[model samples]
Target chain A: MTIRDEHLRQALQHAPDRLSAPHENTSRAVLSYARQTLEKEQRVWWQSCMMWLKKPLVSNWQRAGVGGLATALVVMLIFWQMAPEKATWPDAFPEHAFNTDKNNAVALMKDKNAAELNAPLMRRKARATGAPAQEQTMATQPGHVIGQGEHQSIALDHSSPATNEIASAPISAPAVVAGANDSSGAMSSANQARGSGSQKTEAASAELSEAKPVKKDAVLDIMQLLDSIKNEGGQTVAARDISLSKLRMLKLDMSTTKQENSAPCLQMATVDASPDMETGYPVLMVSICDSSMQLINGVAEYNQQMQDYWYRQLQKKNNER
Target chain B: MGESITTDEDLMRKFCAGDMRAFELLYQRHERPIYRYIRRLMGGAFNAQADDVFQDVWIRLIDARLQWQPRENASFKTWLYTLAHHRTIDILRKSGREVSVDEGWLDDEPGSPWQSWPAAHALEPEQQVFWRKAGQRLLHCLDGLPAMQRAAFLLHHEDGLSVDEMRLVLNAEFEAIKSRLRYALFKLRACMGAYLPPMVD
Candidate 1:
């Protein structure tokens, strides 16, 4: 601010001005270096990308958002791959070949007999077992005289003429009948029934022959009743969908039907028939009037023994007379 | 109409975009001031390294063109001087010269080499001679001052920087710049006063 300070400032300014300028060569060299560097420094595409990545392109919030979105996408993809596929109706119900429309199903059940409705299924099963489809249908028909053991004969009153002839023929030797009741007692009953002719066994056989027609009629009535109930219930009886309550109700109905008949003993057993076309579930068939057979949970060995004893007694009386 | 004068920042931007003429203009504009800043800061003993340091400063400015941003309230000249100041300091330090800018050197009593010189008579010729001698002595006095104080003095007086610009160039606090300038002016005055005759009131 003072004269002395102002003078010193001026002196200092004038003293150092233009005192130590760089030589022309140094300036030329620096410019030449700049030119060389600018011309030659051509970065490749990947190098440019790397440079961009190395720089802070986004803020902390943007980075977090991007990371979270990527993580969520990955998790969703993993879950989508790991999830189980759902079973469609066709996969669950292989018998989709049968009518699915409620009205059509009821009409079909009403118009067709059990044999006619089960014909397709029976054909499939016959193919699987390597048996003729006609033979299988005839074997399941009423009054077919399906014998269980070598000496045992079952006679129904509605018997076909050929089956009636076979039932009435005298047993000279053990006969190996081809039927659905292929039980283990088949061969053993021939020897067991040789010398056991009791009066009770003969009387029971006569009673069975007399009541055969009633039993046949009762079985047909029960089948028609069950078909009507199934149609009214608006549900097809699939093998898997048949609950225990429905089976119990069927057993109660059969017991009522038996009470109405003159047959002293009525037995039933649930046996697996052919597998369904699509679902592969075993079709359930209820065998009635076979004392040698037992319910699903009953002791088959005891029932078979009892039936074999009765059969042997009947065969012995036939031999004696 | 007057032609628009292009600012240093504009020239630097044009240089960054590959205009060699802009760079040449920039280099020409700053060459003397920057070179003298290095030379003065390095002092007479390290004068040989000044050219190298000066070239390094310009080369650094050239290399850093891409990274340069026009700072708020600071010019390209301040930035250039800053680079020169730092490079000169680095060279001095690497050469093992005493580059300390601490205030410890301020307390050292002024030498009496100017005491034996005869007084100038009150004539224009003698006055001119006296002032010329004083100018040469001022450069010598600048060499004796501490690096930071000398920088403060030369930056303000020679390069015509304001106090704030000196703060940016020196990378020091405002008050620190003020104190360094004050000390620089005081020391230069004391040194030059030894050559002045007794005041005639």
Candidate 2:
């Protein structure tokens, strides 16, 4: 019969039974802990509510709704806190140490040398234990890992030794900040000097030494500035108008290399980068120009032939339209 | 008993009214059953994680006591066991480790624990050792049961809930409920017959 059968029920009634008497101390201990926790939370909520009453952002009607939302977000954040960290890089990348076992063919030619290399094979047999593989790789390679061609058109304005060159980049026009409250060549004095018809460029690198809001629209603004400078600085037309494609292809070392002052932030002087057209290795050019097309510093390399070609093409399209 | 201690609800009301002694009495009545229930339902599968589940179950009870009128129809013990059951089932489901619930596995079977009586007297001592043994034996028998059958049996037998009550708990049909209980009892008797051999009180 099954344990639920009447015979099994009768058998079980007399079956050896173990009963646990609760420990008075532990019971008291648990009760006190629960009470204290609730009391503490109640006190904290009251204090925060009092603070809110003094200067409230929420309306009386919206108070409960806001509190509920905040509570939900807090609970979500707590759950998220318990979640395992997701791997930052895609998983397909070769195992970080997979390349280390290279063919040192010549070095290991000798039979004795081969034996020595294999000596520690047993001792070094350490499996990746508790920590994850991602952690292992991160623990090894500690800095910015930019793949070749991944961001050729991007500027990593980092302060490593290479960025000192960026501070003195060849300027071909007055640097115009399109969104700058005043693009009246204030941030451009450095640009006019670079475009002074001098093939022999001077090394005048200035690094803005201050924390500035890194703008996502900074590249677009820079492109607009190139256009404005080309039109306004008419006579001082130097090389070519910076196109969006060209800007995308070019990477500025906007990474803070040196600090000149707080307000004068994020300024990196180009070291000695030849104009991309000249070197064929993509170059980032910074220029400063006035509304009247005056070159304060930097180069105004606006290619007249290209600009005219684009202008005529546009005119043709407009006529068709 | 004079000052209103008819049920767990009464004791809880007294406890909430600052009667520390009443709270002690209630814990004495429940601590083992809840712990043993948890041990049986999720022993070694979540053995290390059992302490955490135990603490969480009690914390939930503490919260329930602070707010609700305790219970009237479903005893506090049954309610607590139900919470433990639901929480555990949810945990297993979330981990994607549990199998699909098939009522066929629980369809009418015989020679199970709930079908007979001798099995109920399994735990004989609690002073020092058998209490611990009972917990282990309970977990072993439960692990041997099909998940649905196991859940049903616990709801009906250990939890002392009626078939209708179990229908609500398992969300199963009335006929399906009977089958699960039968199947669970059959499996328990087979698994624990040696551990719960006939004995006299």
Candidate 3:
């Protein structure tokens, strides 16, 4: 629009345009250097570690080792589980030597595991007192027998014809006779034989010669035992005799008598030969019988309170004398 | 590789994408202008120093290939000139040379461009002599101008850069570049007005 603007534009338009060209060598040298650098990076050895990480599948060695370990572990566990355990006795005591009934009797001489032999006793107690087997084990507190005693027997008076016939026949003790009442009465028969026969004979000889130590003057805790029986809901039987030294066998009548009848059945003598808990004492011999004193096959509920009461009375009488 | 029709920016992108052929085309197209820029910025000395700066500008372009992004308004020519301008200034500064922005020192000088003129006519002999004198006087005036003003003038006239694009190339404020170009034109007009061909009326 003005004079200066027109002239200035014309001057800028005619400005010198001289510029020299770049030499040829410089371009070729720089391009080659860059390509070499890229190629060198591609050829490096450490890139293999990255390639290994990028691999998708597991290697064959890993699969074989892991699967083999798993299979061996499973097989070992199955074989270990399938192996059966053998029952072991102490090395000093041979297993076969104690397998006979005689050694079984000796093993039970302490009577600690008399309850293991309690299946027949359980059945007889169930029959006599109408109590459950578990309750019978809780109710009965067994006492030991004094050495060389004249055995007194108790019988349940059953009016059944078969039991009446068994009641009519009586067997002398120190003899092995089959019981007439039931197969479960076989233990009572064996108890009768053992109490009166060879075992008692050997025990009396051992006591007379002082070859065996006799445990005497032990505390008789009949009250706790009677309470356990009374808690079991049974009739309190009375014991007429209290001479524990003269007492030996108890006879239970396992006659097929229904327990609903409330009769004075257990005619046991009250004898206190109770001992310390750790003392291995035998269960007093019990003979199952009917009214005629026939050795009947049975188990009887022993009324411990009546026996303790009578035993205490006898002790009082002996002290007075 | 035919560079006549291809845009500078497209060739820059192709070169950035690792096409060496595109880089060669781009270098050929830009090398002369960038070299002249450096030479003028170096006070018109076409020496080893100027050649080193010239090579450095292209080398910088090659190194920046991975980082180049196509942008709006800033063309490849502007970017190339900017690299040449900065490298030249840096070399000048490192060598402790001051760019003469002082137009006062240029006063009382007679050999300035446009001292005499011959109108465009059928008089061929006088026009050729006038043209040579005009070119020489222009070179002399440019040499006398300040480094930054000369850069602004050259980037504007030689590279055809607008004020904003020259802002990017000069790495300068818009008004600073605008003023520098204005001052540069004023000095050139005051110096070269006499020798320019007369306007055809």
Candidate 4:
């Protein structure tokens, strides 16, 4: 270093000596203040925490690790809340009941038989009440039939052998029947008769069970009918025709004759009618039958009339009633 | 007989442990340079006299004693100056006298006062008086320097801090500290040249 540089350093180092030093009293004051400060200082827990957080000694990576752990804990808590529960099915059914294919099929068969046994009672109850009963019955049964009228609907009860027999019969066989609108007393009496009829059905079912192959064929027939009807847009013959024993006999013959046929066995024609408007003629009389059926007596009466004439006749007939 | 020298870090650690003697020793060790640093750096700013800033630095150091740690290659002295440097710079900034270290004050015209003074050789008979006046003029020159440049100069020359230690004390980069020291020296020399003779090879 140059002499000038050395002199400059020496000059600067000695320069402060020319200036007045802090008084000795200042030192005493500072130390006494420090003693008092140290004695009086009291840090709370939060203050200590804040000091730690603000501490420069804590590295950036450590702070980052703490933040990341907190974020992960929050995310884990959210997922724990949103997670789906285990064991959603009812406890009455064992988890293993449907574990195997064979067990699954057996369970399903028992359910089907139980549903069939319950269907007739439900239908009887529905007919005894009215629209509300029909809706309740329909909720329990999968099969639905929309009638010709916009508001008329029927829930097919599989427990009735005649209805099942008609479902299994050839499409061209059963003739549509026109029945009088029965009063509540008539329906209650009919339900009583059906209750007695169910006893006979149970005996027939017992006999069919003795012939296992025949019972299996019957079940197959029912399943096939349901599948075909479902595939063919779920329409059925009117409820009035379904209750007729004459059509039941005709369907029994048709089912026996066409037992081997795999084609759709049931044909349906939906007739649209307004439930509020009373028809002068029976609802079945106004319905159009398929070409395969001979409407022998009603055709002559309806052939020469316009729709307005029938409507006028219906109004007059309703007035007389 | 060998006397064990207690390092500044050791003194600070003892002070943190409530040793008043250690604090007194530490305070006395740094008292003069620190007070001069504040006084000279603040340089006639109103209400920022050296004693006030000096007491503030010591009080801050005492209050934050528990937070002090002996970093590798850094002493308690550097930390103490760091506090003083920051506090003085804050005062300088608030008083609006904070000059940029990079300001071009070296381009003063030939008619400047320092240029008109008699050369150092002409006053060889009164060397003692001339040196005293030169030292006083050097202090004046220091006050005229930018706050950071003055701090850099004082930290280096007055406190014997190396460029690296000055970097820690001033919170500046190595190159920045180096440049500040260079500017400080150049300006001081230009101001001090009026008192010294041109060297003969």
Q: Please give, for residues A1-321, the per-residue lDDT of candidate 3 as tens digits.
A: 111334334443444544355566765665565455345446556575445544667565445444544664564356336533221212212232223232111111123244344435434534564544553443233322222111111121223333222222321111111111111222233323333333323333333334322211111112222222233422232232112321222322223121222221121212112311111112232222232221221112332332344345545665686
lDDT of 2 by residue, A1-321 (tens): 123444333332322332432345545567786667555555667687766755666665456445544654564356335533232211212123112112210000112333233333212211212324442332233221222111111222322223222222332211111112112243354344223412111111110111122232332344444545545552233223232222211322222222122212222212112333322222343322232223222222233323334344445665686
Models ranked on TM-score: 1, 4, 3, 2
Residue pair clashes in candidate 4: A148-A271, A148-A272, A149-A273, A280-A314
Docking class of 4: incorrect
Model 2 misplaced regions, further than 4 Å: A1-29, A37-321, B1-4, B14-24, B66-72, B99-139, B192-201
Off by over 4 Å in 4: A1-4, A16-19, A41-321, B1-4, B46-48, B104-125, B199-201
DockQ, structure candidate 2 = 0.06
Residue ranges of candidate 1 with Cα displaced over 4 Å: A1-4, A41-321, B1-4, B103-128, B194-201
Q: How accurate is candidate 4 locally (lDDT)?
A: 0.50
Residue A112 accuracy (lDDT) in model 2: 32
lDDT of 1 by residue, A1-321 (tens): 211355666566556344557888888898898887676465577686556546687655445444544564564356336533231322222232122232111001111244454556545544554555555655345322222221112122113443333222221111111111112233123213122333332343344334332222222323332333333331333121232111111221122122222322222222222332222222223323221222211322222222333344445665686
Best of the candidates, DockQ = 1
CA shift at A91, candidate 1, in angstroms? 57
lDDT of 3: 0.46
Q: What C-alpha lDDT, on a 0 to 100 scale, does residue A210 get in candidate 2?
A: 16
Point to the candidate with the largest lDDT.
Answer: 1
Per-model C-alpha lDDT, please? Answer: 0.52, 0.43, 0.46, 0.50
Model 1 interface root-mean-square deviation: 3.6
